[model samples]
Target chain A: DVKVTQSSRYLVKRTGEKVFLECVQDMDHENMFWYRQDPGLGLRLIYFSYDVKMKEKGDIPEGYSVSREKKERFSLILESASTNQTSMYLCASRTGGIVNTEAFFGQGTRLTVV
Target chain B: AQSVTQLDSQVPVFEEAPVELRCNYSSSVSVYLFWYVQYPNQGLQLLLKYLSGSTLVKGINGFEAEFNKSQTSFHLRKPSVHISDTAEYFCAVTPSGNTPLVFGKGTRLSVIA
Candidate 1:
């Protein structure tokens, strides 16, 4: 089974603090994504990386940045965490072959910005 | 740009009852549709996907979805739902080859006993 692991299952940070959420995939997939899950909004894409050192902004990328220094790891960074940024963050990876490729997700990290 | 719409935000059904979660999409090119389920405090899992061929696609946990190209809809259904089936379901769409997926708001399924 493809495994995508997140650095933390839950995190709490004070306002204006910097926060980082890490994700690693063992399948060697070329595409990685970061998303935030909210009650009514569902899952909104924050950022995505197609290759090492490459990144693309998704629908809602404000206040968030991503890093893809290596193929297997993707990191989501919150420059200044705020209460509005508290959400369940998810990471997913998929192969480069086709767009229909199934993405494997990691157990999300629930971040609480106080 | 591709976009998805999940009409129902919440669906409540009795255990062993049939259920359907409606989803619609707008895309310029041929699209690939997918239904994903996310349990409480967990990640989203692929329930089913409709790439091509047979319009009906069956997935894990006895969940299935039908792809209607003409209607631009891909609705997920289950003959009989269980209590364990309670979760948030999301419908997503993407263009044929190599593109990012556009997800709908999601439908929350609450199975009552």
Candidate 2:
């Protein structure tokens, strides 16, 4: 079974503070993604990394960035945390298969910005 | 570009009842469709996927979905649902290759005793 683990299951930060969410996958998948889930908004991609040190902006990338220093780890960074940034963040990884690869996700980190 | 639309926001059914969650997508190119379920406080899990070969795909938890290219719809259904099936179901689509999936707003399934 594939395992995707997030660094924190819950986090709290003050406004204007910086925050980091870490994720690691044991499957050594080539593609990793970061997404913020909101009620009625579903899962919107924030950033994704196809290879080490390479990243691409998803639909909503403002105020957020990502790092993929290694194949097994992906990190999401918030430049300046705001109250509106409080939401559940998810990390997922997928292999490089021709067909649609099934993405495995971590439990998710629920960040609260006060 | 691709987008998914889940027409139903919520569906309530009693145990052992049948249910259907509707999903539609808009894409100019051929795409892969998927149904994912998220339990409370948990991450999304793949319930089923429609890539090729068969139009009807069966997944875990006795869930299945039919991909209708003509209708541009991929709807999930279950004949007899259990209370454990209560979760948020999301429909997603991606173009061939390494493109990221576009997800719908999701449909929350609530199964009562």
Candidate 3:
């Protein structure tokens, strides 16, 4: 089965603490994305990587950064976790092929900033 | 850039009743549309996708969506819904070429028995 795995399913951090959310995909897809899933905002993209070391900011990139050093791993970093940053984070990877463009998603990481 | 709009934030329906979740998109480039469902506490799953074929596309769990280019809408519908169908539905668009998808705010479908 195709899989996108998030290293942490749940996490808690103190305010102003640095946080790292890891994601890995076995599909070897060219496109990987980081998204924040809020109650009503749905999946808001934070950042996406189209290739190794190549990244682009999405609609909401403030206070968040992403790294794609390898083909299989994409990481999201929060410089200073805040109370409002508490939300479910999702990781997804999609193939570049236009014929088959469905994305595979990870289980998700629920982070709470105290 | 492409953007998606889900008209309803929530839809409450009884079991076995028909349902429709509306979605509209804005984009200048050609686009591929998708419908995804997310159960509580889980990741989103692809229900169906419209790449570039028939306007009416059938998906998993007896759900289907009609793609209307004139209206720029792709609406998901099910003739009869089950309790298991209660979940959050999202509409997404991928503008032609190499680009990530843009998702709507989502529509919550609550099926009451």
Ranking by TM-score: 2, 3, 1
What ranges in model 3 sit over 4 Å off? A97-100
* Per-residue accuracy of model 1 over B21-85 as CA lDDT, tens digit each: 99999988888888999998889899988888999999999999889889999999999999999
DockQ value of candidate 1: 0.67
Candidate 1 chain B: worst-modelled 10 consecutive residues by lDDT: B93-102
The residue-by-residue lDDT of candidate 3 on A1-114, one tens digit each, is 999999999999999999999999998899999999998898999999989999999999999999999999999999999999999999999987555588889999999999
lDDT measured at residue A103 in model 1 versus the true structure, 0 to 100: 78
Query: Against the unseen true structure, what C-alpha lDDT does each candidate score?
Result: 0.91, 0.94, 0.94
Error of 2 at B42 (Å): 0.4
- lDDT comparing candidate 3 with the true structure: 0.94
DockQ of each model vs. true complex: 0.67, 0.72, 0.65
Q: Candidate 3 docking category?
A: medium
DockQ, structure candidate 3:
0.65
As for candidate 1, its clashing pairs are: none
